[model samples]
Target: MANRVDTLVATSPIKCAADKFYNFFKLNMNELVKIFPLAFTGVEVLEGEEGTVGCVKRWKYIIGGIPVSATVKIEVIDDAAKSITFAVLEGDVLLLYKSFKATLTVSEGSAQWTISFEKSTILTPPPELYIPLVITICTLVDAFLLVN
Candidate 1:
């Protein structure tokens, strides 16, 4: 078994205020899914309370035009810091890796927010195959938020 961790820290500029973008992701995730169909096909709350710790959300998505889904349990949600962490409990990613976790942090700027996305995986094949896909998710979200 091989354990590998791939972490990425990136910042992008948005046209909206920091609070607006923060609230949209932290509070209005359902709406976000609706607006960004290219990123997420469906989002269902499977367990616990949404946005709270232990909450599980199953996200249906089409990556590379192939249907895939990931059921993740919310590990941490920090309102003050504007961050949320999700641990993959089941779904497509498990087929390739033993474990996966992703954390996204949004920090306020003058008129933009910087997103720090960190992902860790164990028993995965190659970082090249999965890392870009993870980063693309963040990029898609950023573009989606900026326009809508």
Candidate 2:
């Protein structure tokens, strides 16, 4: 069978500063559950420490009103570029993809999200649904940051 590797990218303009938005994901990821209870149910540090490379986190988030979880490892953190990359180690996402990685990049006025993956089988659909999910999260976070 042929390898089905693909990438999806999406960008959204945010109200917050680039560094502040990046820091929220980099340093204060744990607070996501508390700040957005409807979108995220929990975020637990399974290995290593938060805001550091090699940290592993188990995230429980909502998709289509259903709760889904993913275990991911922090693969890269580029403060200069304001980007963080996460490798999905396991969980519901793995069921559809043989390999999966996501990168979030924040710039002066916007945030870009990229998802790279290899499908587990030809029958598996591309992760198109995640585009809106990430966009919604970005919009919500932007609003939350503006108010708080």
What tens digits encode model 2's per-residue C-alpha lDDT throughout 25-131?
Answer: 89987877877788889888999999999999999998777789999999999999999999999999898899999999999889999999999888888888899
**TM-score between model 1 and native:** 0.71
Q: Which ten residues in a row have the lowest lDDT in candidate 1?
A: 110-119
How close is every model to the real structure, measured as TM-score? 0.71, 0.94
Top lDDT model: 2
Residues 21-108, model 1: lDDT tens digits? 6666556676646665776789888888765789888888776667889898878777777777778888886676566676666666
RMSD of 1: 4.5
Candidate 2 runs further than 4 Å off: none
Worst 10 residues of 2 by lDDT: 29-38
Q: Which stretches of candidate 1 lie over 4 Å from their true place?
A: 110-148
Report model 2's TM-score to 2 decimal places: 0.94
